[model samples]
Target chain A: MNQEQFEIYRHLAGRLIDGQLSPGSHIESEQELARKFSTTRMNAYRAIKQLERRGIVSRSKRAGTRVSAPVNPNLLRQLKCEMTRRICVIHSRNSYEYLHWTGEFRRTLQQALAAEDFTLEDVHLDDVRDRAELKEKLLRLTETGIAAFILSVRGEEDEFLIENSDLFFQYHNKIFVYQSGAMSWMHWPFHTVTVNIFGEGSLAAKYLMEKGIRKIAYCRREISSKNYLDFNRERLLGVEFTMRRLSDGRNKPEEWVGLEQIYRNCMENGSGCGLIVSTDELAARIIDYFAERGAKRPPEMISFDNNSEYDSYRLTTIAPPHVEMAQTLGRLIFDNIDIDSECGFVSYIKIDSKLIINHQE
Target chain B: MNQEQFEIYRHLAGRLIDGQLSPGSHIESEQELARKFSTTRMNAYRAIKQLERRGIVSRSKRAGTRVSAPVNPNLLRQLKCEMTRRICVIHSRNSYEYLHWTGEFRRTLQQALAAEDFTLEDVHLDDVRDRAELKEKLLRLTETGIAAFILSVRGEEDEFLIENSDLFFQYHNKIFVYQSGAMSWMHWPFHTVTVNIFGEGSLAAKYLMEKGIRKIAYCRREISSKNYLDFNRERLLGVEFTMRRLSDGRNKPEEWVGLEQIYRNCMENGSGCGLIVSTDELAARIIDYFAERGAKRPPEMISFDNNSEYDSYRLTTIAPPHVEMAQTLGRLIFDNIDIDSECGFVSYIKIDSKLIINHQE
Candidate 1:
């Protein structure tokens, strides 16, 4: 396989693999091939002879060169099979609505996919409002001749999936949904992955409890945005459940408080008041609030999403496995693409979150 | 190597591999070894001498054969490393409290783990109720010297985790949790997996909307058992979100009506009203009620967790990917066990459910 032969072989293989040069396609004469590659006619003949020897094609001076046709239908399908290496990623409005983390998530995922030789076919659905429009957008995106997708959706858009149910399932083998709100609409199984936000909450409760902090004040945004209602609600439920388990007739905090109230109340009431804030920024601010008023944080404190910028702050927080998640997502989508297995089980992948401790600020 | 020499060599290799014959241990004399495996004294001598040639052991007339001290710490550690293939599995009281799906989930998961050569060490927590007792149970389970776990929790028992948080994190690398109630506890990072019920709800709402049912009544138990409260709540929220998205100037039913009311109200109201029941059984019953009343079920209907037994009923139900969930659980636990990278990402796997439409009664 010399350089010219290798080049010619690769080009032919690509065409054959992509079905452009399907099982029965004919190859050009040696003279015509020589003109195409600007190579000698003898060299073109050698390339055709090589293809003939491999049984990829039948060649003769009288009959010309024709790709070998399969006798069996299954064999022909196998020979004509083309793999989809290009991936189109569509993030949910929720990912966009909360720009701080999800925005970075989208970028990191794109980079990771690119590194894996999966070219990105970006589908912008950041403005897909209401169920009908989301359906239209998703259906339109699927129609763009893209065979693979990584679609993220808030639960609200799932109704659109119900509208395009069969179409989605037909391609479910090639579809991956991340951080989806469509769990209920799972009439069809496919690969779905999300960071376990609810899990993050339970972890926080247990951590504060481990520090032997009794009556831990559960903290979060006094009023979170609507898109994150489910996120905030589920996490709070986890903390409350743990708080109940630990209460044990102990004078635990009576209510879930906001940052200002929790900080003020806990600082004023006592030091045994432990805390679990939903975000690291909120956690750091609570710490700062105490410091500004010439007080130290309660004995126990933990936050969510360990913001690396707050390394000096040294607060314990749950770290989302963003990099590993992107890697795993890429692996699952490519590794599990069996177009005919649409009725098979849907994999719900949950990437582990880390609890980072020890900070100065 | 002769037959006798090969036999002698194999026996010593087995002992060395098993760490039964560690460094500084002296091998018996050739005469003494001749008694074992019925090998000749010469063959035994040859085996020890061969070991000496390979620097695996030292030989001296007085000392007999002594295993050599490892020169490299890494190599020593590699040689000393033992595999942990068994996992301790604990199911929440909630999974048990209900005798239907969750029990099946527990059994299927156990079987799946066994098929993968991973045995489950069932940590009996059926009697555990109080936080202290749950803590005691967890502490006792960990003490069994089993490094790996697959703990399932209802958010209720998360306090016990807080009790043993430190001990849990120390062995966090080997821990896996399924059906976890402790997602809120993200105190330690390890593998955690659970089914996403919220996704199920969104799927239901989408399905109903796709049927063009405007007044979709959300139906569920007026007051479910404490264990399934979060389960029902999250799903209903998914439906409500979709309902809100679908609701325009059209007159919609009041939020979250009871089962009896939904069946009665929707059946009387004719074709415009649809229903998204919380379960297939509930949906089937609702349909039956309409049938019994000599009325046709509304144009649109969707349910959760399709009971395959009701094949004749032909209900569209979201079937939980239990088998696939269990299999994925087993694969993720074993596949992601990077013995070297201990304090790393532990994936929280969420298996996707299937929505079966036109499923026979």
Candidate 2:
């Protein structure tokens, strides 16, 4: 798409030739690489997606992007099998407990690797932020013969790294990201763990309607995320669809309550309200708030699970199949499917949530 | 006391002097080492306990054994500081998510640590049967320059480790374990986050008595834990104390109800009953089980909290302070206290629990 992206592709291809980037290894996210090269997320995504299309990597929603397995003999035949390939795992400090599932996953991975006589060196970096620090760490990994990396990047900071995919490629390292949607602006070869946000939203709406709730409110945080916005639009559409089915040409409702406006409305009204909370934790908090303030509870409140260990509110929620998702991702990484090929690839995987009704609200 | 213990102490002292052992690192449990070394739990406990008495290590209920912080050569040259240099953290992971306010305490610990520039590394080994894998991982950490470890050991496994502390110490590690009265027989400490079972049980009993429930059934899981047994015994004592104060030395109740048996008895007799379930999960399960089976609901039921995330049951529960505990433990670790000293040590820290009354009990 651009000179920088082309350069990145060249460098990445060179690494594949030199065996520096091996099969079944995970690369850094587009955001991480963009930051490293001081560029845009668009460019970075372009470079990576191109590589992916070339069968260099495989991507999924929960597993992020990873190097395809089945070694390309022309690329790695010269390297020793026991060189102790180093891999870096970067995660936010606050997410330590939530990510503990990784520990168990890692153990299982290690055992699997050991069975095949492959040695792995893992380096865990916690509370990582700042582009310079990230670059320094990546450089260190390279200096120490690190073959690949796994990162969970957060926020808008990813944009910078996406633009610099060419620079990353020049260094003979592959980069991958864990995103849930198509980056229409970028044509680079990269992999991602994409979720069916639209479908999930529709399901939420349908579930609420089934409970005999006509007046509904949707609550979400103020943060801007493409995934969140996509889900919101889809959920609204689903609600409208259900409403239209029931109304028989009746007039549409005039007001839609936002999260900030929920408390006032809840306090003012006694009943006949249904709420679809964006996340379970938030729903719990809202329930607790209402309880403390002596407000009448809603007839039905639905929430989405985000792998939290504690729920602040006693409510009915839809839980994601986290374990199943984790396992599927693990299998994909272990298998190392070709990114370019559509044959035998799982294009989409959607999980359903169950209704767990509690007594509190 | 025994040959194995004598050797363990000898090895422990060597590790301390060599700087291979660090302050606040957890050692193997008495039962664990004993099994590994083909010795008895008492032998292992005696050795570690002897070291503890000599100011070489520090031990507590669930916290496991740990090497006291060594005096900094620089500090030693200046002036003597009387501070206890050991750090201890006691944690409990039980399915009883509704019990004892454990989760709340953990959060408090996290907040406290956040105020400082330190982070906690948690490795949750859900079951003790994975000890060999745990040991391997621990050894790998040591190789990767991790100086201390915290863990929770369970069952007869405590004796094996304590008896074989010599081998463990030689590997350059320390441990702390929680202990409470005669129940030391259940000492299976790797490194634990302990709870005040006796105190909490007594409080629960007192609260129920105040609510006018004289014939209360203690509903517990089929496979009980040491904490459960301890809490039940203490609660019984408290209930007895309260009854003594209220009665004129005439009425004495002999029958107590276990969870399963209570259901059968109630069904056969059509009697109204009040219940105190061991943990929240169990309580929720009991409710679900009855509702599904078309059994009449109990009049009143109370349960303990381990701060579980599932709120599907929403029964009345005693909420633990897990957040606080996690925060506290994080701070203690960051402070870098010396475990070898007895002076200036806080013997025990207990947080109060609150009752959250919900319907559908």
Candidate 3:
């Protein structure tokens, strides 16, 4: 942690990079390093662990640690520049859509960094399945020199990661790109990008209504996070707002559709109904579920994520501006890294979603 | 190149794995090994490179070379088992369907291995844009230690990977799992998991016929690889087969729609047409493109991949038996690995596609 220790590690890393230390060559012992750098053995060990994590060195119990000679220099240089500074991209495995977006985000980031003469060594950590595992992985990355991380915090996991923000920032300055928008409650020194879920919902409703669909139903997941709760509420309000202006006195604008009941009704007779789904993939399933039971097709349907794998169904839906979000985040990270600014505040960047109509209606 | 050198390398590898040579400890120099084994230095160097590629050794100009300190020990051990040997999984960018199937295959393989106290290690290679790159990456894995590789060979790039099958078999025997019914011309000694592309095409044609959609249109990328050509031919045959069957001495199936003309017609009058797409993503885009132009919605539409992403749009489709194929392949690999016999061929596995009808029709 001190400047002297940092300099010593840097010098050793430079030697390893230049092939001077040579992979398989035993690195100077902790005592030798301590004497050379005028540091404690503990500090030297810590530095060695850091190098090992970076894939710069290989350590074994019987074999003294040595620089890894086979480390791709190009990959190393890029990783050292991008990874050592600290940043993480996190997401859950539950939502294939989210997993995909995360992959794209990482790919775009990698491409962007390569363009700027940097390399990104991705550290994939599974979503916090349990509090202990979450804390351990988070701490490991932060303590080992990851400066910033992009995390898709969802449900209760949001609170746990946020509660440990101080611990994370202690190891290095952190930047969080919150995908689910729950970070609004946290006062962390990070930036966030989120889908305009409420806006998307309203757009879906409007598209359905435009096709003379009055009895519109909204289907969404149970809200576990405050942001998702707000999103659900806001979407309802948007649907209500549009319906109030366009509806006749007899019919209300929007109705809550229970997950279980929707399938029964869809199978019995889906005609004269319009549905606004939370996601394109879910909508496709609902459609399949109904068709399996020989249900009439709805006049209009709206879903989300035009680029979803199910796009073959040609669902009219709302699509997130993923490329734009990626570009924006890349710019922000580069700017922050360049300036080395101390400002720690959350800046929410909101982008618009597009409505795509398909043949299936 | 000779059997003797192969024997030597195999002996050294066994010692390395048994910890006779500690990780980060240098092995005999190339010249020394050549003299000791009465072989050329090139053979020794090749062996070293092979070891290096397997993450068993780290080699460099200065560091000399040594075994890699195992990072994922359990993973490495699982990889060493003979039963888990002849299996590989390949992936591509934006090809979520293929990637998802690959993941499923890996999981199935793992489960099968776990039942027999064995597990498999996945060799993931991505961003393979061309044949040269694909062949290079595949050969690298095979030469290192992979016994089999599963790849989605479609297009000219795939041809390159297949063309070099002799080189691949020279290093290690392999089995390639391609897209459904994608393999046609057989030049290599390999088994394939054929998808029922003809069946899917037949089903699509039948569905269109039932709907009285005489003016049917088909859209797909121009065939390049032998697999694609086969898939295209089968689909066309299915269409012709259906039309001939349905013809009651009066009406014939409509002309095969061309992409350029389809785009023009959809732009002019999007309604009153039936279309079958190769993929859900493309179908979604076509729908969106027409909607943006204020064209009327089509009467009937069918797409592929009952993937969740397309749920938003109520579209009829045929879902590939991805999970089934993965499970089958996993079982096959597990069985082969367990046998560990030099007798190297397995019967080709074929999976059927299921029709998933939604509100789209």
lDDT of each: 0.60, 0.48, 0.57
**Candidate 3 per-residue C-alpha lDDT over A293-348 given as tens digits, one digit per residue, 9 for 90 to 100:** 77644556776667557877778887766666677667767655532243322244
Q: Model 1, range A1-361, lDDT digits (tens) per residue? A: 4456545655665576567776677878888888899998887777776667546799766777888853333222222222344566665444322422365666777776676455776666557666567656654554344547666555533344344443443322366776523133332344666665556666777687776766666677676544445566656655655555444324333445576787668857687677777677787787788888888766577887667666677887787776766767776765565332333334555555778877554
Error of 3 at A12 (Å): 13
TM-score of 3: 0.36
Model 2 agreement with the true structure over A132-191: per-residue lDDT tens digits: 655566555554443334433321224444433323332323233333322321122222
**Model 3 docking category:** incorrect
Give the range where candidate 2 chain A is weakest over 10 consecutive residues by summed lDDT: A74-83
**Whole-model lDDT, model 2:** 0.48
Looking at model 3 chain A, report the run of 10 residues with the lowest lDDT sum. A338-347
Q: Which ten residues in a row have the lowest lDDT in candidate 3 chain B?
A: B338-347
Top-TM-score candidate index: 1
Best by lDDT: 1
Q: What is the lDDT of residue B45 in candidate 3?
A: 81
Q: Point to the candidate with the largest DockQ.
A: 1
Better of 1 and 2 by TM-score: 1
